[model samples]
Target: MSDHHIIDAKKMMITLEDVNKWYGQFHVLKNINLRVKPGERIVLCGPSGSGKSTTIRCINHLEEHQQGRIVVDGTELNDDLRNIERVRTEVGMVFQHFNLFPHLTVLQNCTLAPCWVRKMPKKEAEELAMHYLKRVRIAEHAHKFPGQLSGGQQQRVAIARSLCMKPKIMLFDEPTSALDPEMVKEVLDTMIGLAEEGMTMLCVTHEMGFARTVADRVILWIAGKSSKKRHRWSSSPHRNQQGPGSFYLR
Candidate 1:
């Protein structure tokens, strides 16, 4: 990486220009464009069909684009499966659903990816797994199965699992949306700790509090499009939403 990459460090690991997508005749994304930098923190929010999740999903090729370009960590996502795989290994994602394996112990969940994807030594992978589990404040529950843990604990495990991949960037799609009201804070706190440590994150969430604390900017997804243009909330944003809708990163 050159100084251009360094100075432009916030330049964009994921970039989309004039991107469009559709599901059958239903057009989902409309000329979507987004740019995420090396360690910048961004929050994406809006009404349900606003296409917040679709935007990030496009970065990893989870949702195929009908038109436009997506560049992840310098690699352009395309028809090549190999390219998509490379991008995924460099980018980690934590979803709304905890998505933990019910039959697997928490420790196993954390270790499986590093061992298989990174080809890390079993002992080393286990050590790294333990390290991240501790970071998520769940090392004590490592041997317990997902069914045995609370929703909050499972989300912690999910975070640990993603970190074990050692991704250069992290994507969070409404990570705390599925948690119980009280359990939301724990996971958000864990994310806060990571943000404080300078992890680049693109989060789709209604956690205005979390966004206010750490976001460099806020990106809104209109209908199904996430614009390349972004608005900087130099200071903290204020919340003014009434009950029916949710406010994020305020």
Candidate 2:
């Protein structure tokens, strides 16, 4: 519980300052810095291996940064297990693949985390899970196994599962990449609805159409670093002057 503020911690939901990471001898992230305000939707886009996924991964301490600071909801990340757990409780993540339990039904999968991690009662967790499932339009399939659902439906379930935690910030690491072409839109539509509701999100994706529709800012990650050029669509009247794909440099 480090109270030391890096950048008006009261106003920013997430802050990463001079963050750096390495895998063995290879430097995976270089001096990464970012600040996200509550309710802001940010898109991180770039080619493969550009550190887009790594950045969001570090936020929740899934992949710890070897250097610099990461603060989420005023909790600075460190070796302190309590601080890490606190941040994880406030941030929910949706991955590229739908990592659901094959043995559990959709409702069960969604309720497990809340029951175990959040110490919620089983009945209460199930109620919360169903609330989010309906929000994602997948409540009717709540009793189905993950394998029984379509890719889009499962991904929507994944999103709902994350929402069950009642997180203040959501991180999406190319959530639609593993979906079929026809399924991508359904997942994106669910995400768009989340954006409209003012959920604070940081997403990594190449879907320019989704970015154009919901992103308050688009950041380009290149070669382990975020590009200097950023597109701030919310305040820029010329945001649409160029095509969606033209917003970020390749």
Query: 73-111 in candidate 2: lDDT tens per residue?
Result: 989999999999999999999999999999999999999
Stretches > 4 Å off in candidate 2? 1-7, 230-250
TM-score top scorer: 2
- Model 1, span 1-250: residue lDDT tens: 3556444423577777678988898788887756676787888888998878887898878889889878787787899889989999999899999889899999899889888888999899999999999999989998999999989889889989999999988999999988999999999999989887989898999997787777766776768865455344433344222111222222
Question: Model 2 TM-score?
Answer: 0.91
Colliding residue pairs in candidate 2: none
Per-model CA lDDT versus the true structure:
0.82, 0.89
Q: What is the Cα-based lDDT of residue 187 in candidate 1?
A: 95
Per-candidate count of clashing residue pairs (backbone under 3 Å): 2, 0
